[model samples]
Target chain A: MDKLKAIIESLLFASDAPLTIDKIKSILETEDRKTINNLLVSLTNEYDSQKRGFFLSEVAGGYQLRTRPEHRHWTRKIRLMKPARLSRPALETLAIIAYKQPVLRSDIEHLRGVDSGGTLHTLLARGIIRVLGRKDLPGRPVVYGTSKRFLELFDLRDLNSLPTLKDLQDLGQEWPNDSK
Target chain B: MKEQLKNKSESPYEVQLGETFEGPMDLLLHLVKKNEVDIYDIPVAMIMEQYMEYLKLMRIMNIDVAGNFLVMAATLAQIKSRMLLPVDEEQEEDEEDPRMELVRPLEEYLQIKYAAEDLAVRNRLDWDVFTRNVSEDTEACEKQDQEFVNISLFELIDAFQKIVKRVSSKHFMDITVDTISVNARISEVADLLEQHDSVSFQELLEGQDTKGQLIVTFLAILEMAKSQIIRIMQHVESGIIRIFNG
Candidate 1:
C-alpha cells in the first residue's frame, strides 16, 4: 500500500497535464479502485498538513497537481527570472480577451473602443492568447481564447475562477456588469 | 518619546501607506514626491537610497516585492553612478539630454499608468451599456437555445471509427467483384425494402466481406438519398431507417 501510494504520488507530480483515474489504473495495472481513492485522499491530507507549495485538485475530469495560489508570486518570479511589465493597452486587451474568450478580434476591438489588431498580434506572438477556431459566419473571423500559459501566469484554476465584474467593482473599478 | 523617535528613525523607510503603488515607476514617483525633489532633476542618489530602504522594509515585513522593483533599484544605481562620472567631450556632444533620457522613462511610465486608470474607468461604465444592448439583441436570436449545447465533431468521428472497427473485427470471407456497381447495390436494397415494406438496418449492413466495403456502400446510399434518388422513411423515436425506391 505504501509503495502503491508512492507510485501514485510520483505519477501525479510528474504529469504536466491532468491524469484520469482510469488512465492511472491502466498504467499501474491495478484493479483496486477503492485503494486508489483512499490513497488519493490520504495524499491530499498529507500535503494539506505539511503546507506544501503544491496541492492536488480535480479539474477537467482529471486530477492535477498544481502550485498553490499563495506560492504563485514566488514561483512566477523564479520561472520568469524577472517581472514583465505589461502596457496599458496590452493589459486592457488581455482583460477583455480573458473575460470574453472564444471571441473574435473584431468583437474585442468593438468592446475596447480602439484598434486592437496590433495588440492581438503581439499577444498571439507572446503565446498569452491563441486562435481557438474560425467562426462559421460570412467573414469567418478567427476566434481567440486565453492559453494554458495565461492561466499559469495569472494563477487561475480556470476561466470560471476569474474575478467577476462585481469582484472588480468591489476592488474599486466603477460600474459592474457580468457581460460575458 | 526619545526612544520611540529612535525606533522610528531606525525604521525610516517603514511602509505606512498601502502596498499598492501601481508599478515600480509609481513607487519611484512617490519616493520623489516624498523627498520634494523636482521630477526633471531627480536626485538619483537619494532616490536610489530610499528605494533600497523601501525594498529592505518590504523584505523585513515579509512582503514579496516583485522583480520589477528590484530592477528599478539596479537602474537607479546605474544612473546615479553614471551621473557621478565626469563626461568626456565625445559623450557630452551627443544630441540627447542625459536628464531627459532618464526622465523619458518616467514620463512614459506615468502616461501608461494614467492610460490604464482611464481604461479601467471606461470598462466599468461601458460594460453595463454593452450588456443591456447585447441582452436586447440576443432576445430575438432564440436559436441559441440549441446552439449552446456541446456537440464535438471529434465525438461523431470517434463513433464512426468505433462502428468501423467493430465491423472489421467480425470474421468474414473476402469477395472479389469485377463489376459490382454501387448503383446496383442501392437499387437492390431499395427493391428489397419495397418488397418487405420494412427491413432492419442491421440486416442491410450484414453480408459485407470488409468494413471498408460496408462503409463505402453506406455512404453511396446516403449520397443517393441526399440527391433524392431514394426516399428514406424512419420512426421518430427509433433512429431506424427504411429506404424506398423512388
Candidate 2:
C-alpha cells in the first residue's frame, strides 16, 4: 500500500497538469477507486504533516502538486516562465462573460458600459474565452463562453466552483466604496 | 484640481486614460459614493450636473473622452429634462421612475465588478502556485528549449489579415485569378513538409503572387490543421509560427 502511494505521488509529480483518480487508475491498471482514494488521502496528509515544500492541490477536477505560497520568493528565483497577468478592465470583462455566458458582445458592452472589442479580442487570442457559435437572433452576433483553459488558469474544478455572486455581493457590502 | 492638472506636463488624455478611468458608469458610481447618496433614490440632478462638469473639464483640458461618455451625458440630460416636467397624475400610476433606467444598469455593473474583484484574489494558476511541469509526450521532444502555445483560430486570422494586407500592398497589379485550387495547395504544402522538417508560416506564402493564391493557401493550411495533417505552433517568446508534420 505504501509503495502504491509512492507510485501515485510519482505519477502526480511527472504529469504536466492535474491527474484525475480515473486517469491514475487507468494508468495503474486497476479498478479499485477506493484504494486509490485512500492512497491519495494518506499522501495528502503525509505532505501536510511533514510541512513539505509542496502539497497536492485539487484543481480543475484533478490532483496537482503545487509549491507553497510561502516559498514563492525562492520559487521566483528558478521560475522560467514569464508571470501572466490580466488588467483590471480585462478581468471585469472576463468576469461578466464567465458569469453570464453564451453572452453576446453587445451584452458584455452594456454591462461593462464600455466598448469591449479590444479586450474581447485579447481574451480570444489568449484562448480564455471561446466563440460559442452565433446566436439565433438577428445579425447572428458571435456569442462567447469561458473555455476549459479559463477554468485551468483560474484553478477551478469546474464552473460551479466559482464563488457565488451573493457571496461577492455580501463581501462588497462590507467594504466602503470610497476608493474613486 | 487646477494645481494637480498644472503639475502634470503630459497631455490630459494620457493622464486620465490609465486604469483609473474605467468608463462613464464608473465615473457615475464614483460621484454616487462621493456624495454618499442612496442608489435607489439617487440625486440625479446633482449627479448629472457633476457628471457633465467632469465632461466639461475633460473637454476644456482636451481629453479624448470616449463616445460612451457623451452618450451617458445625453442620457443624463434626457433624464433631467424628464424630471423637470410636471408629473401627470393619471400616467404616474402606470409609469416607472426614469432614474430606474440608470439605477438598474448601475446595480448590475456593481454586482459584476464585485465578482471581478473576487476572481482577482482566487488561487490563480501561475500567480499563486507553481505546478510541477514535465513533458508528458515523448515523441515530440526535439524542440525542448522553448515552449509553444497552440496557435488559436483568431491568431491565425490575424496573421492571415496581415498577409492579405502585405499581398495587396505589394502585388498592386495582380488580378483576382484562381490560379491554384485549395486541394492543389494542400498537396503542395504536404509535399513541402515531406522535404523539410518544419517550415515557417511566412516561408509557405513566399512564392504566392496573386490574392487568390494567398487565400487558397491559407484555406489549405486551415483545412490541413483541422484534419491534423500539420500542427501550428507559435513560439512563446518570439510568437513566430511554424508548421510541423503531424
Candidate 3:
C-alpha cells in the first residue's frame, strides 16, 4: 500500500471511533481532501477484496473498520460484550425522534396515543436521544432529537439513511409520504 | 361487577396483554390487521365496541389502563357519533372525513413501527461487529466496574428518611431545644471537610442526639450542595453518598 493509504489505515485502526476525511487530512498535514478520500476508498476496497475478517463501514458521517457480522461468534469468545439493549417502546420513541425531530414530547405521545415519558427517559439514558431545547409553546416542553451515537448504533451514514416510508411497504400497508 | 372491581390485583391475562401491547394505538393497529380492514375506511362502531370490550377486560383483570387509552376511547366514541349524523351538503367538499383524524395518526404510527424494526436489525457496534479498540476495551471495562454517579435529590432525601427513622425511634418523647442551627451545622461540615478529604453522609450524621439536629445537618448539606461548596457522589456498588470539597 502507498504511504497515505497505510497512514489512513493506521489511523482508523488506532482510533476508537470513526475517522472522517477531514480528520485524516489534518493529521496528514495536507489540505487535499480529495486525495485523502480517494486513498480511503482504495483502502476500503482493498480490504473488501482481500476478504479480511473486518470491513470498512461508512457510519455516523465517517469511515470505520468494523469486524464482519459473521465473525461475531468467534470474536465474542475472546471477551464479554454487553450489548446495549433497547426495548420496543424505546425503539419506537427513537424512531419518532429520528424522523420528526426536534419534536415535542406531546407530538410523540400524540402519535403513539400513549404516555412516552418512561420510554423517552430510557432513550435519553442510553445516550441515543438528546434534549435539543424547550419548545416555544406553552409550558415550554422539552424538544428532542437523535444523537451521533444513534447513527453509530444504527449503522446509518446519516439521518437521511433512515428507511423511508416507502421501505415500510413490505412490513404493511403503503401510504403517501405527505408528513411535514 | 362489584366483586371484580373491589379486588385490585393483576390477573395473568393482564400481564399477557401488557406485554403484547405497547399502547392503545398498537392495540388498534393489531385489531385492524386482525380484521383485514383497510386503513382509509374503518368500521368505527364495530371497532369502538371491541375497543370498549378490551377496556372492560382490563378493568376486570384489574389492570389500570392509562388515561391515554381512555382518551382514545372517548375520541372513538366522538367519531362514531359524528359518523351517525347527516352529511352536510354545503361543506362536503372541504370538510374532511372524521375518520381521517384516526387514520392519519395510525398510518404514521405504522410507518414508524416498521422503521423501528428496521433499526433493530441493523449492525450494532458491539453486538454484531467488533473494532480494534484493545486499549479502549480495558478502559471501558474499568469504567463499568467502578462508576460513580452524581447523587440526585431523591437519593439525598432517601438518606435523610433513613436517618430520621433511625433517630426518631430512640428520641420519640425527648423535647430538645433547637440549639444546633443550620448555620452552625454548615460551619461544622466545612470544618470536617477541611480536616478530611471526604465524608460519607451516614458518617456526617453519626452522633446526632436529636431529630432537630439531624434535620439541621441535612438542610446544611443541601445548602452547601446548592452553593457548589460540596459535591455529592455515590458509588454504584456501595450506594453511599460521599461529600467532597468542591
**Best candidate according to DockQ:** 3
Docking class of 2: acceptable
Tell me each candidate's TM-score: 0.36, 0.66, 0.67
Interface RMSD of 2: 9.0
Error of 1 at B50 (Å): 36
- Collision pairs in model 2: none
lDDT winner:
2
DockQ of each: 0.02, 0.26, 0.29
State which docking tier applies to candidate 1: incorrect
Fraction of native contacts (fnat) of each candidate: 0.02, 0.52, 0.52
- Interface CA RMSD, all predictions: 19.4, 9.0, 9.5
- Residue range B175-210, candidate 1, lDDT tens digits: 333323455667777677668754544556655555
> What is candidate 2's lDDT per residue for B1-246, written digit by digit as tens?
243333232321222232223678878877787688888888889999988877775553334578888899999888888888888999988888888988989888888878877777676665566777621111232322236555544356557667667765456344433456667889999999999877888888756886556655776786687566887778778978888886
Q: How close is candidate 1 to the true structure, as a TM-score?
A: 0.36
RMSD of each: 31.6, 15.7, 14.7
Runs of candidate 3 exceeding 4 Å displacement: A76-78, A166-180, B1-21, B88-92, B134-246
Off by over 4 Å in 1: A18-23, A30-38, A57-80, A83-86, A170-180, B1-246
lDDT of 3 by residue, A86-180 (tens): 55667778888998999999898888777778778867877889999998898988999999988877788999987776666565434321111
Across residues B1-246, which tens digit of lDDT does each residue of candidate 3 receive?
334223222212222223213568876775676577897899999888977877775554334577778888998999999998988899889888899989988878888877776777787777677777632212121112125555544346557667767765566334344446566789999999999877899988867766545655776787677565777778778887888875
DockQ of 3: 0.29
Of candidates 3 and 1, the better by lDDT: 3
